[model samples]
Target: MNKNTFLGITGLISCFFFSGIALLQAQSKSADLKNWPKGSSPKEIGTRVADHFVVTPHTNFGKPTPPKVITYPESCTWYGALTFAKASGNKKLTRDLAERFEPLFGVESKMIPVPDHVDYCVFGAVPLELYLQTNDKKYLDLGISIAEKQWGPPEGPRVKEESHEFYKQGYTWQTRLWIDDMYMITALQAQAFRATGNQKYIDRAAKEMVFYLDQLQKPNGLFYHAPDVPFYWGRGDGWMAAGMTELLSSMPKNNPNRERIMKGYTDMMASLLKYQGKNGMWNQLIDDPEAWAETSATGMFTFAMITGVKKGWLDKEIYGKAARNGWLGLVSYINENSEVTEVCEGTNKKNDRQYYLDRKRNTGDLHGQAPILWCATALLR
Candidate 1:
């Protein structure tokens, strides 16, 4: 109990505390430096992605089965390739892909028709961006023309009964808003608005997106695949994942809807993280554990989570691990051909668990590929 002994002990404890703080700070700095690449840039990673898109005629067109001309999933591939081309500053790749769509626009098939205005909305944005980068008015004109079709009063005659059904559904009507619409159209519309300085496109995109958000969100922050359905589909969530990222990237930082959308995104991520399979993928039916772990949804979630963390929209320490896990799971499914397999094809069920489970795999559809490319691109960043 001497004063000298007490002072010596206090000095030793203070040194230990300061040293511990210094050690922790040093570790954090090392971790940050470790994540930083020494040579590669986002643009370089983008070029690698573009190089992966070496499509053969057979791969792109698929084997013909009688009257049905089964084609590779074109939309997702187009988007992924276009994204890579834009990122890498590859004008020829961008132009070639942009021109290839002319045939799609001229075709009349139900599966991949020219007048499928919804898809035109999704794929057109890349062409528009390409035009912006290259000063090619042709791409810009085509993109704007196709985009305008999605807006304004009905321009063309109704081809199918479902078309009218979608119109009547009013956002949940057969074609109103669904999980896929976010990815397929709304993001492109937002980009179109930004590129063209047209408030109409932005307003339309926001209104439709908000309507979809309002209709699909559950009390717990999870969204159903479709408004009329009780099910939450994997690619459906993927659509929202990519859609939100794309939309957020294009939206002005000060826009009023930005905060609401970000909250929705964060809430969705929070709900999603709890359900990630030990294997790192989400199930075909997200809320159901019995369903198989799926790649498309997991890739989209990975991309969204990582992008959110890097942009400071989400806590990197918490969501970053989840994102990394999902990315690893997704990468496990990639084949040597660079084709993404086991993507659940499009589903329409609102109540059937078996339908979700029984969906075919390894088809390498655009639905799967787009999200995978997106996840890879984000990870590379």
Candidate 2:
């Protein structure tokens, strides 16, 4: 062959080889977890959380400032990360988490008067799961202790009135039914039921779901933040959905409330489907298209949708696309360092819609981290 012709042929062969490799790489990036690579997989997100994130001791209940005692929302990240680690089948990660959490039990037991607030007890979900995995009685004891306290009447003696006082400073401890409390109280109760095989834990969890749905769920299937606050705060609704998903997934097959819970969850999901933004995320204010896409709510919805489809509770054809897109939206917020951004910070019920709209956004907050880990674990299923 002539020198010029030989050189041209070699260049073409090299170009084809590189192009073929590029196409193969692109093809490997499938939507499902079948070929999910470690770099961006749900497992990696759990790993990042296990390696980098620390559970903050701050308390968001009843006070703006950090409290001396560790609280339940703080444990949301712990439960999420540990649950993800267990699902990933990473023994070292699980052991590391167990060690990390071991000391907290003592501290929790010695709290001046063990917290009476149901919100304070939410952290028990982690201990409950840990007990089930390792068969350790201490973990079970810790969880049961919290459950026993939360099982009683509302904190104050005035039951009906206190329950409806959404504006009270001690609403977290009171009988007040805010949308956020659904997850805070129910998640731990579900865990308690799993650990003890007691029907009461789940019964309370399910009945309370019905109660909240009647009080807060609107005509469109979305829930108001609270009776006092009329806005459909995205995270507030997300909490309700996440709680219902967890309870229904674990509730007994013959439980009388299963059908009711199922209906509520499906209805809320239908409403959520309509509000999801084009970017695969839900808005901070779900009904308000003008609000920015929020990560925590998106993560919660993605986890719920995927869980429903996998369990046959939701129709795959209808809800699967939204769930997968929601997963993509959540991971997009997770940076290489695994710091999730654009999470709406801890919020309280306020009278005006602008209060929820104007709340500050946070990064790597436990509120956001837990839902992302939950979504990651659901995708694995």
Candidate 3:
């Protein structure tokens, strides 16, 4: 070979060699464990939660009503349990979660959600995750279809001009600035990115997040229920926190939105640290000391903090202490039945503060349970 050809081949080999080394190093780092406090250790908690998920039948937000369609809460919980199973090397769990989902393509096919809304579209993440673990083409097709539908032609009642306008702007027809949509939209697309190694999925998610951040996030780094609603609802903020975490986890390093999204994420974390109750929980009304401590938001924020610290985005010593306390504080709310308590019931935007403060506090709510599982999954990763 000529000298030029030899140098080019050598350069290619060097690139592959370094890339492999980096990959191994990442795997090794993930494999290493930190000594965790009891009940807060990811391995213990993730496995326990994963096992619980396998036994739990699909329910509509943990209510008694027959849930004809799968919901975002169940989808998120399923995805988290699946990841926990994969991370911990639990083959039995991997099988159990996968088997649990297989029916969606068969007997329970009718139960699959229609991707008309953000909540419905997030369900795609679960099948995408299953595809990652099992290499099932059926799962891939189902998930990609759902994810694509989010950005596809706006369907359903054509009453709203906003849907058409949003679609015209190259956004999901379902685009609404609701804090919950951040997680709903991000989960599906981020998982698609992971499953296919596609930059478009992550790019779309990051762009959507930046829009939400610009439109909804406040000077205090928390989000109101809507642009008009002034209250800082805990779980709503949790959705934004978790959404940002998911998007950031998958976004490419050179993504144009990376800096802005990172800034928004870090700013929110700082505010969360300041507002965290002395017991390591965030209040139902995040900024309201009078509001009761809510487990769901605490769990979501804990997950985000743990992820940030793990990824070296935050000060380890400072955020680590806070994250540990958040987990333990969160776990304290779990009853013997394994249900989470003090979860605010499903909420809607209201201008009145008492409406939020007086909202029913639910026991054994999936809103609460899902976030705890997310925290456990973050710890494991």
TM-score of each: 0.76, 0.83, 0.89
Once fitted onto the true fold, the runs of candidate 2 whose alpha carbons sit more than 4 angstroms away are 1-33, 54-67, 106-113, 153-174
TM for candidate 2 is 0.83
Of the two candidates 1 and 3, the one with more favorable lDDT, higher being better, is 3
**Highest lDDT against the true fold, candidate:** 3
Query: 1 or 3: which has the higher TM-score?
Result: 3
Sorted by lDDT (best first), the order is 3, 2, 1
Model 2 lDDT at residue 67: 62
lDDT of 3 by residue, 1-381 (tens): 999999999999999999977854443234233665456577777777678778988887656797989977888888888877777888899899888987887899999998899988888998898899889899999999988888888878632679888888777889888999999999999999999998888888888889899998899899999988999999999999999999998788899999999999999999998898767789999999899999889989998999999998988877887887788778778777777789898888999999999988898667887888788777777
Please give, for residues 201-226, the per-residue lDDT of candidate 2 as tens digits: 99878887787787778889998888
Q: Give the TM-score (vs. native) of candidate 3.
A: 0.89
Q: What global local distance difference test value does model 1 have?
A: 0.65
After the best TM-score superposition of candidate 2, give how far the Cα of residue 360 lies from its true spot, in angstroms: 0.9
Better of 2 and 3 by TM-score: 3
